[model samples]
Target: MSDAVAAPVLTIDGPSGSGKGTISRAVAAHLGWHYLDSGALYRAVGVAAGWNDIDLADPAALVRCTFDTRVGFRDAPGGEPRVLINDVDATDELRTETAGAAASAIAAIPEVRAALKERQRAFRQAPGLVADGRDMGTVIFPDARWKVFLTASAEERAERRYKQLMDKGVSVTLAGLLREILARDARDANRPVAPLRPAEDAVRIDTTGMGIDDVVARVLALIDG
Candidate 1:
């Protein structure tokens, strides 16, 4: 059989509310590449676990949930992609602080991360892929042709998340969101498996005051450069 070159991958990794999702989606659309929201997978698993009343502390149950959860995404041309869990539209729930917390909890479990690793890698397909998550560069796609780690100060990220939730009419306190983001950051950074960090050679962007279009252009410039 003739050898075929593998499709390229661009990874955008960062802590919660770091603009990874926004920038990754924009870049992917510009390049006409497939997109993978790895965080959504974990959130789906967490949501699935809760539906089955499976305890997050139970690693075994979480693994089963990972395998059993059927996660699908439907493109929403001008808005956030719809996340379906078990074919049910759970996009709203998935965007909740509760779901984010659940995802972080399950993500810290080594078993769950291991279970989801292959699933994340499989998103890399023909044309290319823009994979976004906490460990997209470090663990899921270490050899990705382009890798970017976007970060903003804790306060800034919290502010961004607050505004996002407010826009959706989800009541939330800025102080509470800040606390949650700090806690999740600690957990993700100290997690045993695939801790969140920039890959050694990955470009780092502190998008503390940058606009979405500016950030998107910078990332695209990398691949085009």
Candidate 2:
């Protein structure tokens, strides 16, 4: 492989609403590197499966959908990246709680992870890659030069998510979001395959009260040091 193909990666792993997505994108843009939102990939797969009526309970069907799914991403500066599923813009749908639940369910299947592993790695190229997801540092890019794990209180994360949804005009209660965040945290941390956890060498950032720019600066500092 050429040097560009083997470009360094900065993996930012964290639970939902901990700001990894925002931070990673900022850092990547600052460094002029590519960005990978692995969670979006899973969401895309889940969304596609639903469209095809493939039962999430059926590991076989989910794996097939993963293989057949043609996921795409479009950069939308200053906003969330647009996600396309099989040539259709499913960006809005992919961000819904329903899609998140489905993604979580299918992500636990070893077969689904295996199928998406290479697809995730393919984003590494050119200047570098900044990957954001639960296992970006642990499973997908263990050799990443810069690995950071972000975290926040479950309640805080839920509140952040609640406000985001409300801003988007989605009707949701903070209590329900809190419950879902807690449940997903437990499920992700306990899943049998590639469970969610920080790599031993990863720098842990408690972003409970930190601003997005501050967090991005801290991540960039890692490269400077």
Candidate whose lDDT is highest: 2
lDDT for each of the candidates?
0.92, 0.93
The segments of candidate 1 whose C-alpha lies over 4 angstroms from its true place after superposition are: 1-5
Question: Model 1 over residues 94-173: C-alpha lDDT tens digits?
Answer: 99998999999999988889988888888878889999998888888888889999999999999999999999999999
Instruction: Write down the TM-score for model 2.
Output: 0.98
The digit string of per-residue lDDT tens for model 2 on 32-88 reads 999999999999999999999999999999999999999998877778789999999
Q: Candidate 2: where is the Cα deviation over 4 Å?
A: none
TM-score of each: 0.97, 0.98
Report how far off residue 193 is in candidate 2 (Å).
0.3
Q: How accurate is candidate 2 locally (lDDT)?
A: 0.93
